[model samples]
Target: MDIYSKAIKVFGKETQLIKAVEELSELQKEICKFLISRTGNVEEEIADVKIMIRQLEKVFDKEIIQKWEEEKIKRLSKVCEVVECAKKN
Candidate 1:
């Protein structure tokens, strides 16, 4: 599905557009994290990553959405970090 279709599927249209924006942003972030750890074929990997990010931008389309996404990603990391710390300690 295209970005817009995927967004509507995950979150109904009755939901505010901002909610769809947030979900798309989070998806892009997850893809980027996976792309970053690649071991080889940098050119192909970068090309795929750029396309994925551009698709997300088509949905989010604003500075506020970008900033909100970045902040929430940091918060989500804390959740994993805390779980990791508990395992170690």
Candidate 2:
């Protein structure tokens, strides 16, 4: 198994889920700090969150998550198009 899968196997799903929450919280704090001071380890926090998110994909339904991601991307694309059009006007 991959490292992420190995981590999930070594640590139970519940523990990993809690860790994911903690990582997300840390990322949120880092973002807030970065916005306030233009200084913080946001990139590192993002990497941590990404790792936890990958583990979460392994723990849950990846296909469903992928579908939702696609839908959200489509919605974001439409919003971007609107913003771009407004910018040109």
Candidate 3:
């Protein structure tokens, strides 16, 4: 009855994966447009990407994905600190 269930019924794993990629691409495009023209539906594109990501969670292991995401964030945070330090120097 939920959106994910409906989406799964209509579009299977492979189709959903493709749609996810498309949605992410759209989000990226919107972000790039914002950087240049400073006019684009960035929020709407982000929402679409989030919806597609949740739809993806139905097929992928959410816990594992989240765990890896946290690890990546921690690693990126360290990299950000290094970059900041270099900038200050």
lDDT of 2 by residue, 10-86 (tens): 99899999999999999999999999999999999999999999999999999999999999999999999999999
Query: What lDDT does model 2 reach?
Result: 0.97
Total clashes for model 3 = 0
Which has the greatest TM-score? Answer: 2
So what's the TM-score on candidate 1? 0.36
Q: What pairs collide in candidate 3?
A: none
Error of 3 at 19 (Å): 1.3
Candidate 1: lDDT over CA atoms? 0.64
Encode model 1's per-residue lDDT on 1-89: one tens digit a residue. 78655755676555535554555566566667668874345455455555545545655566877899899999999999999999999
Local distance difference test, per candidate?
0.64, 0.97, 0.92
What are the TM-scores, per candidate, against the unseen true structure? 0.36, 0.95, 0.84
Q: Summarize candidate 3's per-residue lDDT along 1-89 as a digit string, tens digits.
A: 89896898787888999999999999999999999999999999999999998888888999999999999999999999999999999
TM-score of 2: 0.95
Candidate 2 residues lying further than 4 Å off, grouped into runs, are none
User: How much does candidate 3 score in TM-score?
Assistant: 0.84
- The pairs that clash in candidate 1 are none
